[model samples]
Structures are given as C-alpha cells and as structure tokens.
Target: MTEFDILVVGEANPDLLLRGDVRPRFGQEEQLLTAADLVLGGSAAITAVGCATLGLRTALLAAVGDDFFGALVRDQLTTAGVRLMPYAAGGVPTGVTVILSEPDDRAMLTLPGTIAALRPQDVTDALIQSTRHVHVSALYLQPGLAGGLAEVFKRARSLGRTTSLDTNWDPSGAWASLDDILAHTDVFLPNAAELSAVTGAANPDTAAAQLVALGTTVVMKDGARGARAWWPDGEAAAPGRPVDVVDTTGAGDSFNAGFLAGRLGGHDLPESLRWATVAGSLSTRAAGGTAAQATRADLMP
Candidate 1:
C-alpha cells in the first residue's frame, strides 16, 4: 500500500515578509509603515501544507540545516499536518527568503542555504516506491537535485508513481536540459512567464501546446486572469476568483496543491482546475504563502 498520498520533493525554508507601500532607495533609507510576518515558505513546503489542508496524506522530503530556522520550518509543517522526511545539511544554515510585499505583487530576495545542498540521493528509492504521487517544485533553486532530476522522475515512473514538476523561475534563464524530465513528468505546472521561458514561445497558448506535445499535461497559471490546462484529449480554462489581494506569495504553489489533491482524489481536469483557482485566489488573502489557504471545508458546497 502507498504510504503517502503525495510526496513533495524540494526546498524547505521560512519567509520573512515585510508588507508596506514604499520601495527601496539607493541611499540609506528606513521606511517601515506596515507589518512583518515570518511564515512557512518554499514551494514544496507550502504545497505540502496546502495538500494537508485539503486532507491528503502529504509528506515533504527536503533538506534543512540543524538550526532554529529549520525548527521553525518543521514546526509549521507539523502544525499543518504534513509528515516530514527532512535531511539535515551539516554546516549549512537553513534557507530563508526576504519578501518585500506590495499590493498586487511581491519581490523576493532569497539566501539559498541548505536548499542548494539537496541532492537526488536525499530522495530514497523506498520513499519513491511508497508514495502514490511525487511533486517537485522550485527546480532551479536546488542545483544538486536539478542535475539528476530527469533520472529521478524516470525512476518514479518506473515504479508506477505519478510525477509532477513545477519549475519556478530560473534565475540563470537557461531553460535547457529539461526536455528529458518533461517527457517523464505526468503534470507540468508553470506560471505564464515560466512557460514562455521554458519553451521560448512568446504566446502562452503556444507554450502550453509545446509542453503538451512532449507527452506531459500542461497547467499554465495566469495570475488574476486564471489558469489554463492542456492535455492530450482536450484543454480548459478556469477563471480566477476575484478577491482583495493582499500578497501573492505562494499562490502558485497553493494552486498546485489544490490541483494535485483533486487529481489524486479522481476528479476530472475541469473540476481540479476549479479547486486550484479557488485555492490560489484564497491564499492571497494573507501576507505569506501558507496563510489564508483553503481547508477541505472551504471547498465544500
């Protein structure tokens, strides 16, 4: 029997969010007019929390330093009911992200600490065999894992496990060397910009089509406008929910959680997209990614 409904393989970090209306200046300047919050972050962690909130038996496999920040990361995941299979990166400190939040969008400054230390070796074969589905997030942030990601997905597929990949923006902008992994992936979740970056297509529809042609389902997340999904059989678009946007920190990850949760529960693509849209839109009601996430009850009629 599968031990976990979803196994999330990626980074584990904390986000220190500073919410305000002012931008940074060149010279020395101090402008603090709003609030500050420390919350659970990292695409994998946030998605795991969102999956747990949706009543999935979610497990997180990631690296963190044996430090206070690591403890905070673990505590938050445990509080959200996600099982942790964390590896401690010796000597390296836990990763942390400084998020400068505006009304519609936010800029993040990340210090990739232990996250860079995560390797494919950290994901054990036993863990892969025991999970029904595997989800990898923030592909570029984890260099150690990125190098062998294709093999990892292939191994999961060989084990009869469903696999998903969410390649969050690559800082280096070299989106090559992903075709092997994309071919093995069952679901490919990318934001509009990431889709364009990965496919080199100016049009979002073309980008999605290109990924679908690779034998992977493409779910393109378009903020405010909504989400679109393309598979072999057909394609569908779900309109985004209108809400007072607070911070769009981990909305995409939240959307992944909802989408994957629905898929694992045997929901069709259209129904899954509806849950994904609502989960992502609701996540923006707070300052951080995991905050304001929808629970199972919230999705009920």
Candidate 2:
C-alpha cells in the first residue's frame, strides 16, 4: 500500500510580492507606491501545497537552508499540512523570489540560494517506495539534483509509481539530458512555450507529439487557449473556461495539481485536462500563487 499519494521533489522559497506596482525601468530606479505582500512560493512547494489543498496525502522532498527563510519554509509547509522529508544541506540561505506586480500582472526576480543546492539523494528510498506519484519541477535548473533525479524517476517507474514532470520555463534551456529524464516521465506538463522550446518544434501539437514519441504522456498548456493532451491513440484539447483573471502566478501549478488529482481519481485524459484547466483558470482569480487553487469539494466528478 502506498503511504503517500504524492511526493513533490523540488525547491521551496519565500516570496516577496509587491502588488499595484509602477513599472521599474531599466537604468532608472522606481519607488514603491504601495504595500507589498509576502507569501511562500517555490515550484515544488507550491505543487505540494496545491496537492495537499486538494486532499492528497502529499510529502515534500526538498532542501532548505538552516536560516530564517528555512524557518519560514517549514512554517508554510506545516500550515499547508504537507509532510516534510529530512532536508539535506545546512547553513545555506533558503531561496527567495521578489515579485513586482502591477494591478494587471507581475514580474519575478529570483534568488536561487539554497534551492540550487538540492540533490537527488534528498529523495530517499523510503519516500520513493511509499509514494504512488512523484512530481518534479524545473528539471533543467539544478545541477546537483539532476543525476539523483534520474535515478529517482527510474526507481519510481520500476516501482509502478506514476511520475509527472513539470518542465517549467527554462530560459537558457539549461539541462542537457532532457531526453533521459523524459524516458521515466509517465506524464509531462509543460506550457506551450516550454513544449516548443524543449522539443524545438514549430507548434504546440508538433511539440506534444514529439514528446509522446520520447515515451511519455504530454499535457500542453496554452494560457488562454486552454490545454491539450497527446497520447498514442489520439489527441484531446480542452478549451479554457471563461473566468476573471487576477494573477497568473500559480495557474500552472494548480493545473498540474488538478490534473494529477483527476488522474488519481481514475478520470480519463480528456476529463483530466478539463479538470486541470478549470483549476488553473480559477487560480488566476486571486493574487498569490495558491490563492485560487481548488479544494476537493471545489472539484467534483
């Protein structure tokens, strides 16, 4: 029996969000005109929080610095009801993101700090063997975690656990061994831009198909256009539901969470896309990363 329904392996950081911002011009300093909100965020941490919010038995495997920010990391996870694995590194300062958002949208500048120190060994056999699903984020960013990640995914696949990869936007296309990573990925969730960049394909469909050829299920997200899934049998697309947009920060994370939740509930591909799309859309109605993520009651079969 699986001890945990999901395990999220990745970074955890504190977020300094400044809303109602005046634009910051390059080479010119802009003064803050309003109060900023501080929140907790990190790819893996957000996903784990979303999973827990949706009532999954979730665990987080991450490394946090032994510092003030690390304390905040633990507090946030505790508040969200996520089980924390033993952390790896000590003394390194935890990661932080400075988000400057206008009333319409936001821009984030990140300090990777301790998040960059994550290694694959942080994911132990005890956690991997007991988890039914394992989700990883930003595969291309961290160097130390790459090799361990490779082994972790392979072991999870061998153990009959579903593995999901959220190949979040990689500006430099950092990670070299993407193909090897995808081989162990049962489901891949990437935005349209990421799909195209990762596969070097001309279009989303082509990119998704290319991913499928690499031996994994692909769920491609196209912001307002909605989401699409490509499998061996055929293709499925879900149109985005109309909703009032607020902040897009955590939209993708919520989508992944909802989609995984649906799949774990035995929904088919199309239904899973629909569920995820709705969850993502709802997330944009609020300001912070997790603001609009749905509860189990919010998502009904």
Candidate 3:
C-alpha cells in the first residue's frame, strides 16, 4: 500500500495581504493601509493543507528558501498536518506575494524567489511510488518543473498512481505546451477563464471538450456558479453553495482538494462536485486561503 494518499508537487510561499479602500498613487507618498497580515499563499500548499484537513494523508514536495518566510510556510503546513519534503535553497529568499485587497477583488505582486527554482529531480521515483495520487500546480511559476512535468505524470501513471493538474493562470500566457502533460493527467482542474485561455475556446463546454479529447477528465470551475466535470462516459455539474464572501485566494485549490478527497474515497463525480463546491465556498468565508477550510466532519452531507 502507498504511504501517502496524495502528493502535492508545486510552489510554497507566504502571502502578505493588505486590505484597504485606498489605492497607491505611486508617487512615493505615504499611503496608509487599513490592515495587513501574512498568511499561507501558494496553490499547492493550500491544496495540501485542505486535503489533510479533510483527513487525507498528504505530503507537499516543493522548494523554499531557508529564511523567515520559509519558516512561516513550514509552520503553517506542519500545523495543518501536511508532511513536507521541501528543498531549502541557499541564498535565495523565500517567495512572497503582496496582495492588495479591495471589497470585490484583489491584485497581487509576486516575487518568484525560490518558487521558480523547483526542478524535476525534486519529485523522485521513490516519492511517486509511495503516493496513491499526485497533484501538480502553478505550472508557469516553476519553469524547471514545467519542462519535465509530462514525464513525471506519465511515470506516476505507469506506477498505478492517478494524477491531477491545476495550471494556475500562466503569467507568460504561453499555454500551448500543456497538451503533453494532459495526456497523462487523469483530472484536469481549471477555472472557466483558465480553461478558455488554455484551449483558446470561447466557452467552458468547448474548452472542456478539447481537454476531454486529450484523454483526461476535465473539471471546469466557475466561481459563484459552481463546477462542471466532463469525463469520457458522461458529464455532470454542481451548483455553487451560497456564502458570505471574503478573500477568494486559494478557493480553487480548496475545491481541487475536496474533489480529489471524494474521488480517492470512491465518491461519484456528482458527489465529488458537491463537496468541491462546498469547500470552495467555505474557503471564501475567511480573509485567507486556509482559515475557513472545512474539516471532513464539516463537509459531511
């Protein structure tokens, strides 16, 4: 039997959220922010935490600098019950994102730092062999991992491990190279915008169909509208749960965690979609990605 239920391979960073009504004028004048705080901020890390919270045996394999921010990241993940196999990069600073939050939406300024330095070798064969599922996230942030991700997923499949990918908004806008990875991905989780962007399709249905043609199950997430899943056999959708909105950071990752937990536990697609929607909505109830995450008991229908 595998030692871990899920292995998350991706970035780890701390988010510095600045909540306020005022915008910076950029003239070097002092602008006071209403509130500021640091919280867990990487897509992969958030998903790993969510999975562990839902009672999955989860591990995170990523890179972080041996610095203050890195320490914070480790503490948060460890507290959330996620085993860490993190590389400590010397000299490089730990990655950090500055999120300027408004009432409706937010903008982020990110420093790549150690997040961009993750390599393929970090995901060893031994790791893949010991996990029942593998999840890859933040494709564009880590060029080294992105280059060899296809082979990684293929090898995982060969070892009888299912795989999932969440290529969170590519900053470079070059979404053409993910087809190879999708060939080995069992679950492809993308937001409606990401689905459209990656496939160049005008609609979510077309985007999902294109991914389905690539031999992967496609789950298109639409915030507030819930999620839709397309498999070879059939397609299903779940309506979004109503919730008072806060920060939407890592909501998609939380959804991925919920869906994967249900799938690994033998739940059907529609049931998994329901859990996913619940998780996503609940995540937005707090100011940070992980604060309002639901536990397994809380998610029980």
Candidate 4:
C-alpha cells in the first residue's frame, strides 16, 4: 500500500484571528471590540486537516521554524491526524497570518517566515512516488517552489500519480509563469477572481474554456452561488450550501479538500462538487479555517 493517500506540499502556519471592528488606524490608535483566536492556518495545513477528517491518509510536507508557532502548527496537525514530515527549517521564525475578520470578508497581514522557505528540492522523487496523489497550494507565496513546480508536477505525472494546484491569488497582479505548471497539472482549482486573473478571459466561462484547452480540468470556486468544473469533454456544477457565517479564512482550502477527497474516493463529478460546496460552506461556521471543517459523516447523503 502507498504510504499516503495524498501528499500536500505547501506552506504551513498559524492564523491569529481578531474579530470586531478590524479596520486599522494610524498613529498607534488603540481599538478593541471583540474576540481573538489562534488557530491552524496555511492552505496546505488546512487542506490536509480536512482530508484527514474525511478519512484520507494525509501527509503534509512543509517548512517551519522551531518556534512556538511552529510547535503549535505541528501539534494541531498531529491532533487532526495528519502525518507531519520534516517540520523544521533553520534561520527563520515560523510564519503567522493576522486575520482582521468580519463574517463575510476579512483582511490578512502575513509574516512569511518559513512560509516562503519551501523549495522544490524538498519534494523529493521518493516523496512523489510514495503518494497516490500530489496537491500543492499558495503558489505565489512560495517562489522557490513555484519556480520549479512544473518540473515537480511533471515528475508526479510521469510516475502515474495525479496532481492538482490551487495557486491562490497572485499578489503581484502579473499572474504570469503558470501556463507551464498548468500544463502538467491535472486539476486546476481557483476562485472566480483567481480564474479571471490567471487566464485574463474577461469572465469565468471564458477563463475556464481557455484553461481546459491546456488539458487541465478547471474547477472554479464561486462563493455563495457555488462552484463549477469543466473538463475537456464536459462540465458540471454544484450549488453553494448556505450556513451561518463566521469567518471565511480557509473555506477555499477546505473546498479543495472536499473535491479532492471526493474524487479520490471514487465519487462522480457532481457528487464531488457537492462535497466541495458543503465543506466550504460548513467551514465558515467557526473562527478559522479548520475549526468547523466537514467530516465524512457530515458529507454523506
């Protein structure tokens, strides 16, 4: 048997969620009104937690420091049943994202310590060959790995393991250098905004068409309305699951987990999309991403 059902290679960090009037002011103004929480963050870490919750044998390979936050991250991952591998990196402190959150939206200030420390070489050929699937996230945040991810994906493909990418948002606005990676990527997961930005095709429909032409299955995550997926031959969609909103910190990452776990577990496209939408919607019921993540029982008919 394979050592892992899925291997997630990306950033791992913690999020400090601050609620209430989060609008910051200058001159060191003192402002407070609500609650604060420190929770497991990072796209890869959250997704791994979700996958494990859904009963996948998940493992995470990411860099972090030997600091308190890193220890917290490792502890949370362990508690969530995700196998943490090679957790420490030298020189940098562990990364953290301070999320100033409202129910529907949020702003984040990030300290990219070991977040940017993951390199392509860290994902060895042995690691790729040991897993049934490979999933990567937060592409723009890890330039070292982002620069060489296409090669890594190529290796994964060559070994017969499937691959996926959730590039997240490209902060530079350029949205360049992804065509090569997408060529080797079997599944391309992006939000509508990220889809539009990456493909520059005016709207989601056009962007999905453009990307499917590159031989990638585009799964566009549209909040509230739902998510849609397009393969080269056909298309499918799933409506959003309505829920009481809390924080939207890691909903997208959870959606990724739902879709991936569904498909890997042999569900069809429409069913997988249902898994994704439900997982995404339910995740917002808590302060941080993984707090309210869906379980396999929660996802069943």
Query: For model 1, how does the per-residue alpha-carbon lDDT over 149-210 read when each residue is reduced to its tens digit?
Result: 88899999998999999989897888866788999999999999989989999998888888
lDDT of 1: 0.90
Worst ten in a row by lDDT for model 1 = 21-30
Q: Model 1: how far is 45 from its true place, Å?
A: 0.5
Q: Which candidate is the best by lDDT?
A: 4
lDDT by residue (155-257, candidate 3, tens digit) is: 8999999999999988887776689999999999999989998999888888788889999999989999999999988999998889988788889999999
Clash counts per candidate, in order, are 0, 0, 0, 0
Candidate 4 lDDT over 1-301, as tens digits, reads 7899999999899999999989999899999959999999999999999999999999999897898999899999999999988755986999999999987788888899998998888899999988999999999989999999999999999999999999998877778858899999999999999998888777788889988988999998999998999999899999988898888999999999999999999998889989999999999998899999999998998
Alpha-carbon lDDT, every model: 0.90, 0.82, 0.90, 0.92
Worst 10 residues of 3 by lDDT: 20-29
TM-score, structure 1 vs. true: 0.97
Q: What is the C-alpha RMSD of each candidate to the true structure, in Å?
A: 1.1, 1.8, 1.2, 0.9
TM-score order of candidates, top first? 4, 1, 3, 2
User: Which runs of model 1 end up more than 4 angstroms from their true locations?
Assistant: none
For the record, the alpha-carbon RMSD of candidate 2 to the native fold, in angstroms, is: 1.8
